[model samples]
Target: MTLTFAEAGEQDIPDLTRVMTRAFDDESRTYRGLDKGGPEGYDNGDFFRQWMLGYDETTGYTILLDGEVVGGLIVWIIPGGHNHLGAIFVDPAVQDRGIGTQAWQFVERTYPGAKSWRLETPAWSLKNHAFYERKCGFTKIDETDSPDGVMFVYRKIIHPD
Candidate 1:
């Protein structure tokens, strides 16, 4: 499947919410160690809509597949260092299909001067950790707790010339 990256605007919030809800639903379940149906609930798109709308545009990027939003990345440039990938998400159904990797590659190419790119994933998400380490070239620099109680942190340096 072909994936396309785009700069999302206010109009795309509905689709973004749909994809994020599905992706985060599973994430919340896994972090809580609960079955598909559990007390630890997940946030819907409204939550992300509010949060993302508040972010400055220069650092935010979104990806679409076949003209539909399937993923997004929120980044920020820190004063003394490289940009941080604050959040990246792919639609649950479309994950493991290289959409995320391509999106990251897009970011790297878009910001070549960045000394490093940092992001965090759930400590228990072995799949994600391995993907980042082996495929994305990220390293484990530290660990921290999620507000919901999960723990892990990782970083990767996007090579510079």
Candidate 2:
């Protein structure tokens, strides 16, 4: 039951890709009624590897459960406290157990200077919508039609007290 975040590296690409693929596939199967989904290279290590080590303006972490890679998260830390949450995916087998929430908390704590966090998700992903809006306090700022489907953009603002 121990959960941790480690700086991701090239060695983690395989595990991260596998977990990301599983999460995407689960979403497709459950929500989209499709056999598979996710953007290009979603299931491949090439995409996962890009974020694993050092990608432009991005900081990535591998979510570990009992020292095993179970998920991955990436954030684009733009200047001026305006940042973007690129992605966060956990193994479908371990979904809904607060791991994703913990990972999010980690982001906030690790970057106290962040004034806002923005991200986009597919409109059909009700599970993701709940997690970001309900659990993480993100507000839907915009919704746009994309080639894939309707896309929802969310933002969580931090007011310095």
**TM-scores, in order shown?**
0.81, 0.94
- TM match of model 2 to true structure: 0.94
Candidate 2 lDDT by residue in tens digits, 20-135: 99999999999989989996678988776565444678878999999998999989998888899989999999988999999999999999999999999999999999999999
Error of 2 at 53 (Å): 5.1
Name every residue pair that clashes in candidate 2. none
Residue 141 lDDT (model 2): 93
Model 2: ten consecutive residues of lowest lDDT: 46-55
lDDT of each: 0.70, 0.89
- For candidate 1, report its TM-score: 0.81
Error of 1 at 56 (Å): 3.5
- The CA lDDT at 109 in model 1 is 83
Q: Which digits, one per residue and each the tens of the lDDT, describe model 1 over residues 1-161?
A: 66888776667767766676677767657655654421132244454554556656335566888977887877777655566876778877888888888988888887777888788776666677877888788889988876645546777876553
